[model samples]
Target: MTLNAETMARFAQVYRDNRGAVYAYLYGRAPEHDLAEDLTSETFVRALRAFDAYVAGDRPIRAWLFTIARNLVTDEMKSARRRRQTPLPDMLDESRFVVAEPDPAELVSAGHARDSIRSSLARLGGDQARCLVLRFFEERSIGETSTVMRRSPGAIKALQHRGIDSLRALITTGAIAP
Candidate 1:
């Protein structure tokens, strides 16, 4: 379906409203800031391209948007070839807000911690890493994580437990410092 003026307006509003959360979600999984930004751009491009197929009542708009974002990250991790990232539709630039940047020293400390956690998560294997990121970094509820991951809430709970255990082991072994 062609995005009529109304759909175009709605899509633009969504891009403006949801970009930051999408960026943060990608940021936790991406290896670098630039890749997260690139993935954020690509998520909306794919969302709009596939918009015709989206049925509004199937899920919350944020959920749909995140589903797109999650798939892109997974694809990026799996693919050898890098796809070109797309720019946002024209009007999105106008409404973007500037936030003060974090301190460089704190940023370095946080980046090290994040890398350590990610490394531990990688060692844990399976969906445990994704589960922890969704639970903690993304600030998603157990039910929301279950929906996003297509797992049962019980399964998510189990993954969370296992992921935490793995992280604790890493800390104990001096794999990651407190």
Candidate 2:
């Protein structure tokens, strides 16, 4: 399909609006924040190039962008497995010492909660983690998640249930704190 100025502008607007949510979703899964940001940029670039193929839907642009990002993450995971790369947890821990601007007290508390969720997510299998991210962090509806995940609503529900269960177990085990 031919690229046009209007289409490009719309894609840019959509990317700007959804980029933070996409980054959060990626950061939830990626071992390193830099890698997550890199993948998020790549995802938007890919989405811009593929904008003509995007369909308008009841779900927001973030859901569509997430589907694409999820696919990329899956491919990366497959490649990592084939290459026998270092485990995700080890990689995550290696990057945990980065410095960021100081947060306020409430922000620090919220950050702690997010860190707990991230730690629990890291323990989940890829599909489960993706499902949870889409459902919770992305705040997508069940139907939207089913579309992004390419699963039946029932299946997505089951995964959501099991994923939450796993997360709760982690919280109880102190792998993550509430």
Candidate 3:
């Protein structure tokens, strides 16, 4: 599909406006920062390439960007599965979590607890991670998260419960203090 000048402008605007949020979203999904950067770039490229096909009311562009990013992550997961090996965790030491670059004011206000929370959230299995992020971080409704995560509502709820439980465990262990 061809993105005419105006559509291209709109797509670019959307990309610029929401890029950071999308990057942070992908950062939580990807195994490494470099992979997250690549995936974020691919997401924008795909969104630009598919701009003309994007209907006005199907969903917000932010949500649509996530849909694209999710597809890229899914494809990565499939390839990883075919290779058949246990992937390494990004955070081997809890100390690495504390050494993050100086955070923004909002993150500071949210407190170190949020970073701890995100770290725990990141530890969830893929579907649980997807469900938790979409429902809580992205503020998507249960139905919307189910649609994006491609699971039944019951499954999402179950994952959400387990994910929160594991996060609580992380908190209790002092791996991440609230």
Off by over 4 Å in 1: 56-67, 70-107, 148-162, 172-178
- Global lDDT scores for all candidate models: 0.83, 0.79, 0.76
Question: Over the full model, what C-alpha lDDT does candidate 3 score relative to the true structure?
Answer: 0.76
Clashes of each: 0, 0, 0
How does candidate 2 score on lDDT?
A: 0.79
Q: List the residue pairs that clash in candidate 3.
A: none
Q: What is the TM-score of each candidate against the true structure?
A: 0.60, 0.55, 0.54
Candidate 3 wrong stretches, greater than 4 Å? 84-119, 122-169, 174-178
Query: What does the lDDT read for residue 152 in candidate 2?
Result: 98
Candidate 3 has a TM-score of 0.54
The TM-score obtained by model 2 is 0.55
Per-residue lDDT tens digits for candidate 2, residues 1-178, read 5788898788778877888888877877776678888889989988887789777778666767888888887787777678965555544564668767566988778777778878778876587888987887776779988988899999999988888888888866855322
Sorted on TM-score, best first, the list reads: 1, 2, 3
Model 3 misses residue 154 by how many Å? 24
